[model samples]
Target: MRQVPTPFPLSQRIPEETAFDRRELAAILSLYGRMVAAGEWRDYAISHLREVAVFSIFRRTAENPIYRVEKRPRLRQKQGMYAVIGPEGQVLRRGHDLPMVLRVLERRLIRSVD
Candidate 1:
């Protein structure tokens, strides 16, 4: 009997994790900073998965995230690649541009100012 060698090791065979690029992170962080300064957002987490990247915003460290910004490259053609999801798992906004999609959070900043 002969054994066939895999092209990639088992540890590396899965699809590469998707993540936010430098420019995307910069834009997201800029909004995060503003929200933090406004006292509307307190914490955040970033996650890279096989098919999506997420940036979750939290009002407190121990609570569930209040909002989540997501990137799904697989949806880039049909429904855009970016989305803003509310705490209840509702889609607040979706678009191809990161800054534009993030305007949903900016609205929160507006409400906080009043």
Candidate 2:
């Protein structure tokens, strides 16, 4: 009989740290909460990958995500670190400052007073 080989452990392949920090989360979640209260958003998800971290927002559980806030460390030097992508895969904004990048989404909160 032939012997079988066991697979390696998962932890060994993962990195030690994440790209997004507490300050970034705070800024993102703060806006998210406000949008939620406004009834513009309902669900959200977070993903930390080897190259990037993504915060996805959805209007409903079954529907596709409305926006994706991504943090890519590699792009920090080139096109800033934070980026907000629309549902259609277009970049709404990209900047080094998290709060500034997020401002693009906040603009949607405005409405005509008339």
Candidate 3:
């Protein structure tokens, strides 16, 4: 009889945690919904890395992200915890509160219909 190979032990695996909490996701999704309704955004991608978490927004699935929302726990003490980056690699906004930090993107939702 052939024996099945066992997987590696848990101790040898990498360990990591997500940066954003449920509340943070809720706030981001809320804004995303609004932007989607306005036809401003089409898709989004999320990545949780060892040092930071990023929420990337794209106008199309095949295109590059237009905005990125990031969370860096290490920056919590110096420059708050959250940051919003534009397509040009500029720091649009940064603050301790996720919602407040995201408000910079929300401002783009405004339009004057003449």
Candidate 4:
């Protein structure tokens, strides 16, 4: 088959997909490991979309995500790129720093041994 050239330039021709870099994934996975050890999280999933990258945490494989850590580059200048969302579709925290935003969940982990 012959290739058909589009009107858009080479930069526009390529589809953009958002994703987590190694450092970002490292931080997220570090928290995930702790949560798993604490028995707060079990199953997990990662999604890379055109607009956002998401890491969903689940208590069980069959259940909806208990939390979602997402990165939206568009929001970087406005409300920051990193966000942590709760199960009820609420934004738990949003910030320019991934570790800072993740502190919301860390607080929960540090509270009460029970």
Tens-digit lDDT track for model 3 on 1-114? 999999989976655865678989999999999999999999999999988999999999999999999998879999987999999999999989888899899999998889
Q: Candidate 3: which stretches are off by over 4 Å?
A: 1-15
Better of 3 and 4 by lDDT: 4
- Candidate 2: 10-residue stretch with minimal lDDT: 11-20
Model 4: lDDT to the true structure: 0.93
Task: Quote the positional error of residue 59 for candidate 1 in Å.
Answer: 0.2
Clash number by candidate, in order: 0, 0, 0, 0
- C-alpha TM-scores of all predictions: 0.85, 0.84, 0.84, 0.86
Ranking by TM-score: 4, 1, 3, 2
Error at 98, model 4, angstroms: 0.4
Q: For model 1, where is the 10-residue window of minimal lDDT?
A: 105-114
lDDT by residue (2-114, candidate 1, tens digit) is 99985877865656898999999999999999989988889999999999999999999999999999999889998999999999999999999999999988877886435
- Can you list the residue pairs that collide in candidate 1? none
**On a 0 to 100 scale, what is the lDDT of residue 109 in model 1?**
80
**Model 4, which residues run further than 4 Å from truth?**
1-15
